[model samples]
Target: MSDVGRDIRLVGRDLPVGAAAESYRALVSELKAAADVLGAVITSHKVAVVRAADDLIDSLDPVAVECGEVNALRREGTFLRGFARDPMSVGRVVDEIWPRGEHVVCLGAGGSAIALGRHLLSRPEPPSLVFADRSAAAAAHLESVLASRTGVRSDGSGSVEAASAVVHVGPGPWDELVAGSPPGTLVVNATGLGKDRPGSPLSAEADFPRDAVLWELNYRGDLALLRQAERQGVERHDGWQLFCHGWAAALGPILDLPDEAATARRFAELAAPLRPRTGGQ
Candidate 1:
């Protein structure tokens, strides 16, 4: 907001994942009732919030509908609107680093993973996806969503060429999966472990794929996964770019700002100084 010269006050609301529908409904009702409140940018509870308060929202953008999540909320003259800007935000960061035809292994089957899958499948030549989550339900949900969008199937075959697959992993220690990825694959830690929770998706013993790009989707926190990537001498990306792009995409609708690359770049430049410093910064 400071980048756009808007004097908006940002507030933080930390809601646990899978909170009851009433909790989200109350929050949405409060926001709608508050005339001074502009809107909000959701983080971990994107999908949960949307599921809980679907009927309360006056409108939802196409992406929100498709992804079953809402990362941005806006109020428009007595109407409450929801938008899932993660695809746009994730696309910007992925396009810069992702090599065409390289496999993608996302460690979480949450909102960000779904967004990444959706963006990748939209490409003319979609890269094969491997989504792993501790929760069978979450992995199945991601598979179902992707299957509806593209005719991809998950048959436990683990065939990157024929179909994408969702693997239900145990808690921690994904050494075999991480080490077995093809060279130059894009390995992502979409699980909120490093940020929202403590710890990393991969154990310290895990070895990253050769020439792979490791993307840890957390700008701040312990960020053990990022440190592991660095220790292994692989090219790594943090979530700072995604964070900036997400805010820019959300604020574009809330503040009526221009949606263009230049604007997003300027926003990133302005936000750079405020980014949290991790180890060896």
Candidate 2:
């Protein structure tokens, strides 16, 4: 808001991970009914909210439809608009760090993983993507989502030629995936463990790939994974840039901002002081 010179207040809402569809519907209805609520940024409930309140949203951007998630909401008169801004935001952060055709290991196969995979696979030279999740369902869902969007299928085995694959890390360690990745791989923690939950995706014993770029998608928290990266002398990036770019992307339509990049830069400058001085920095 400071970047745009608008007086806007952000309120945080906490919802359980597997909340019922009706609960999300009620929340969406409340936002629509509230006159003062200009817009909202959905966090962990991106997919759940969209699935539960698809009828309540008047418009969904193409990305939202494709990704089956909604991360931003805007109310226009009687209509509430939904958008999936993760792709745009995650793309901004990834592009700054990723070179084409490198390997990428995303720890959590959730909404953010879908967005990141979608963006990366769409590139002319798609990188080898390996998505890992504790839940087999989540990993399968990510594979289906990516296949639907990119028309590229993963052949169960994570062959380089497949370009995309999912691994179920149930009752096992994430260390193997990280250790097996080729040098210069981009390892990402898309899991909400550090912030919304506790602990790191990779255990302390995990060995990071040589010349790996570690990306922890949480700017504030215990950030155990980030600390581990720093300890190993890996190049690291936190989610601060993604957070700024995501808000700028969402606010573009809500507040009708003229330049999203400028707004994001301004937001970063303003929020820099408040950012946690963690290992990634």
Candidate 3:
């Protein structure tokens, strides 16, 4: 269990329904009997404790939010981590797309989007990031918060000259929002649609440059959109790498893991219970 970051194991019941409680309890009970077990992190990705069994698990252990339920679980001492509903891991991928940028357009005002936006602003000379959503009120709130911190206007409407990256929150249609864009634009998908499903962050209507990098944030397995990008002559990035990026980003506060090359290798070798077997066969 002490395989660097691999020491962190994600455990959960097979289904997103009721019976998982007893199953989870059994798993915990078994782990407690082990020698080097440190702590457990219950993931709240699909829903928050509505499953009768998950509620039971929540009653017994600490939980981690997948989409951004930090405020909801703040009193519970749950730490914040980004989980992209989209196939690509947006925060980590965006960091790769633009290590430093003038501006970033973030579609969707969910938890992961806000978390990444905040992380960006925390960087020394952070990029000007914008939060956009169908809910005008949601976007307005995020915009106000960012404007106060970074002093850049977050009107959610402007030119790429004013922004460098455009991240779509979910698999929702974002091409309409970015129809008018300059070339060499950096587009990112922050939604969870492509994680275990098929869909692009942007729509087929808009013309995303072939040279553009079409990154999906899901970081699970092979995504349908990856093939689409390949056919379109666009470069595609695997989603799992983003998870590695995220783990590295969160190493300091979450696990305090070292960042040396060997440390990374050791961390990758560790088995993570967080990953699930997709398409239940």
**Top-TM-score structure, candidate number:** 2
Q: Compute the lDDT of residue 142 as modeled in candidate 1.
A: 82
Model 3: what TM-score?
0.55
The candidate with the higher TM-score, 1 or 3, is 1
Per-residue lDDT over 8-110 for candidate 3, one digit per residue giving the tens place of the 0 to 100 score: 5644434342345555446444444545444333332323222222332233212223221221211113322322222122344566656664444454564
Give the per-residue lDDT digits (tens) of candidate 2, residues 1-281. Answer: 45586888888888888899988998999999998888888867898887789999999999899888898899987689998888888888788867564788999989999989999987766777888888776777678778854445554476434455555657545899899999999999998888888799888999998999998999888989999899999999988888889888878878888998888998888888897887774
TM per candidate: 0.90, 0.91, 0.55
Q: Which is the leading candidate under lDDT?
A: 2
Candidate 3, 243: how far from true, in Å?
1.0
Candidate 1 lDDT, 1-281, residue by residue in tens: 46665788888887776688898989999888889988887866888888788988999999898788998889876689999988988988889877475588899999899999998887766777887889877777787778865664443466533445555656755777778989998888999888888898888888888898888889899999988888988888888888778878877778777764567788778777897875422
- Weakest ten-residue segment in model 1 by summed lDDT: 153-162
Q: lDDT for each of the candidates?
A: 0.81, 0.84, 0.45
Ranking by TM-score: 2, 1, 3
